[model samples]
Target: MSIKFWRSLPFQTGFSIALGAVLLTLILSIAVYNQTIEKVVTDSNHRISQLISTIERSASIAAYLNNDELALDVTRGLVKNDIVTGVSLRSESGMRIISGSPFNFKEESILHFPLASPFMPDEKTGELFIKPNQQNIDAQAKQMGALLVFTLATHSLMITIFVIFLVQNRLTRHLTDLANTLHKIEPGSAERLQCPTLHRHDEIGLLVRDTNQLLTAVQNTLAGERRLREYTETLEKETRKEAERDPLTNLLNRRAGERAISRALDKADTNNTRCAIMLIDLDRFKPINDTYGHDAGDHTLVTISNRLTDALRKNDIVIRWGGDEFLILVQQGHDDLQISVIADKILATLSVNIDINTSIQESIGASIGISLYPDHGTDPSYLFDLADKAMYHIKRSGRNGYFIHTPSDTA
Candidate 1:
């Protein structure tokens, strides 16, 4: 099907094992065939040599007596067997007697035997040549080849099937199960694996055990980190709230107010918008403290803080700027009229009669000083100084009401 199937471990391993078995079987079969053929050829050659040896004395006797009839009889006897295609007996002076079909020197093997005299054994008379038939050898080789092909095919098929069965059951199936288990196991979960053969002292079993140990470690690590992160988040929230809020009024402190103003200035610079800073100081607040004690002063301050918070827009920020004074930062999209309206609301809400639990209704006014970004002063410190100066100017003119700071007002 796909190339991935061929590349998988099972296919590759099975193919390799089958191929190796087939190759080994083939090589052995070829070697056996060659050895058998060689033995047959050697034995046949030996028998042919023996036959020549048996007739040698007679040939020697015939050659010594110069008997042509005996030489022809010897030649004809040698050619009677089907393996012997031809026979030739040649005398000392090259007088030759041949029997059967003429010999084909190129295609046939020639065996030579010397004829010796009986009386003087050392005396050589003639040569005998025998050419064995090639058809008999070819017939034997064909039979052997057929048997070899059948034997090799049968053994190769059996060996391949056996190897595939053994390998698939013993190795590939286990590995496939392990892989599937690992894929389904979620990281940081309480999941575990128990292989059937895990108790065995094999590499696969060891791998399974080690993997379970690693998963346990990961799960523990994840749990610990989760707890630590939750604790850290809680502490961070409490720390941030403490740093940003005033203890008495529950309003943002001076540090938080400054941070807020800096953020607003950055955003205003980017958006080409404007912001306003208003400073409010209560009139005649020291007298109430002097008359009603410090506890009463704290109560009045808390009450006034609540009133100021209720009067402002949701986006506006109010901070306790110090004793009897508060600072407000308003970002209303460059609308000075909206800022003035908010300031008026704060003044009206503060002017209401306040009961200090002293059987006397007390009322006080606030002196408000407003500053605009990029119009009054750009920096926080400079803008605060300008607003403070304007507030004092309102007090100098007479207590109560509000003043928008300008360069001419400062001059």
Candidate 2:
């Protein structure tokens, strides 16, 4: 069990009150029982002493007269009281004049009194022996002990109940209400406690007010954090988009193109499929750039990029590799025919006349080189290199054409 569970105000209050009452009752009961026993024993002893004192004159006369009947009567009278278990009288000559029945001489201490002679004052006659009854004392002590236990138990129960009631009202109820309110409170929400006790000047009220303040602060902090997070996310998206796009063509740049090729290679490896890497280079593009200027060249590249994007499958990715150079990644390419068809479309699209100005018009073409993943090489760098080499081969043979790299071509 958690400490908080056990430390609940109601439970702690009840347990402490109950345990303290029980312990107090136990200690006091034992103390009172012992003290009562001692008092009973002491009073019995005093009573026995007083009874002997009252009968001292009679016992002295009986001893002086050498009267056996009188001594027997004295002993009998003493024994009648339950506290006096046994009694005996002795003469000056060491003769036992009288003794009660069942008298055991070996018992505890025998109360001894000197018998004075009536004829001669200050002269000794004999002694009287009395044995106090222990059983009677124990019986009285037991009775008092039972009564003490009953009294203590009654008081303990009453005190426990009263303490529990007092603590519940004073502390436990308020704490319980506070705990329930806190439990219902959700961080970063508009939820708040409606406790009227918060207006009080007590510590509990202060605590409640402070807790609500803390919650309000937390809600504000969380809301601000959420807004900040949302703004940060929007900015990151824009930044990433700007980083990955070419300024002129608005197509994927070389960095994004590398990432796309890596993703494509991973997909191809997983699906056991092939993809094509096509490198496209414009034919006779330098002459136009030198004649009409770089703005016209930029415009031409943007035009070609749009046409290529429209002509290829939606799954294919086109990137502006560098000035006047473009790269395309074709997904799920089945054969050379699939790759060649897309390359042919790009060449035909670029072959159309582009309007550089109202008074000027120019025509351009693109040479495309294709390489297959796991056919040319599994690595993207190796495949791109093969495609570049094949594009150069096309440029060497003739411009505005496409060629697929093969081992036989190198031979």
Score residue 276 of candidate 2 by CA lDDT: 86
lDDT of 1 at 407: 79
Question: Which sections of candidate 2 miss by over 4 Å?
Answer: 1-26, 49-71, 88-97, 101-130, 150-243, 269-274, 332-340, 355-361, 372-383, 393-398, 403-411
List the candidate 1 regions with Cα displacement exceeding 4 Å.
Answer: 1-8, 42-78, 85-135, 142-146, 165-170, 173-186, 189-213, 216-220, 265-275, 284-300, 333-341, 351-365, 373-379
lDDT of candidate 2 at residue 40, scale 0 to 100? 89
Question: Over the stretch 228-309, how does candidate 1's per-residue lDDT look in tens digits?
Answer: 9999999999999998999999999998988988888788778777778889999978999999999889989999999999
Cα-based RMSD of candidate 1: 6.2
lDDT of 2: 0.85
On residues 330-376, what C-alpha lDDT tens digit does candidate 2 reach at each position? 88755543776677778888899999999888899988888998787
TM-score of 2: 0.69
CA lDDT of each candidate? 0.83, 0.85
